[model samples]
Target: MIDLLAPELKIVFCGTAKGTISARTGSFYANPSNRFYRTLHETGLTPERIDPAEFRRLLDYGIGLTDLNQVESGMDRVLNEKHFDLQGFREKMLHFRPRLIAFTSLTAARIFFADRTIRCGLQDRAIGDIPVVALPSTSGANAHWTRDRDHWYQLRALICRAENPSWGEEQKATE
Candidate 1:
């Protein structure tokens, strides 16, 4: 699948690989049960819930999408390690220079970090000064992990703060 990326995006969500439905439809998070779009809306990252079919519209909202294993299309267990080009992904991040890079699933983050202990949240490590975050998978296939909105909300706040340094302060004042 073609990566939906551009320079200076607010954030880029990277997945391990395309799920069967996503690959078949040529859209990111194409599976009906996937919460990716809904979470973006609920976290106030987008004005409304975006349809999976119109995934490219994410660019308008300052969001980009990519996959670690671009050559494969399946679940994490089925993806081949050789197809995961971490260096290429890093190079892309260097070129695009998004404010944040969020791995859509902890598995994807683990693959990128090569550290299975990496948690699902902000990491101490970064790629060329760009912050990295790991979010719980929105895939229906991730039955082992419970779905959580807190991380997604945190990501939104981070994006707001990145865009405007006083955004978090203003929010706190309002509260």
Candidate 2:
């Protein structure tokens, strides 16, 4: 799968692998039940709701998209360890150096970190100098496991701070 990436992106969302629907459509998070695009707009990550087919347009908003298992398209359970290309993922992040690498699901974050105990939020870890964040799975199947979208909001706020250092003060003044 071709990655939607560019240098100096604010966030690069990394998922475990594309689903069958996404692979077929040649788009990231093409599954309608997946709330990937909706969440972006809802969390104020993007100015408007973007269609999955137009995913490449996300670069305009300083967002990029990629998956761990590029050669396979399926859920985490259906995929094997060898399918995940951690080295390739590292190379991309090192080369492009996005400000943040946010995993679309906790499962993806755990796999990349090689630590099963990792939780959902901005972690104390780094993929080199870049920070890593974990968000809830927007998959319809995992709907029961999600508590709320606060983690995503926190991520967007962090990105906002990076974009505008005085964002917090501006927000306080507005309130």
lDDT (tens digit, per residue) of candidate 2 on 1-175: 7999999899999999999999999999999999889989988888899999999999999999999998989888999989899999999999998888999998999999899998888889888878788988888878643685678878877776655767889999999
- The residue ranges of model 2 lying beyond 4 angstroms of the native Cα positions read 144-146, 161-175
**Per-residue alpha-carbon lDDT of model 1 for 1-175, expressed as tens digits?**
7999999999999999999999999999999989899989988889999999999999999999999999989888988999999999999999999999999999999999999998878889989888899998988766744546478779977776666867778889999
Best candidate, lDDT: 1
Instruction: Return the TM-score for each candidate structure.
Output: 0.91, 0.90
Per-candidate Cα lDDT values, in order, are 0.90, 0.89
- Model 2: how far is 111 from its true place, Å? 0.6
TM-score for candidate 2, please give it.
Answer: 0.90
What TM-score does candidate 1 get on C-alpha atoms?
0.91
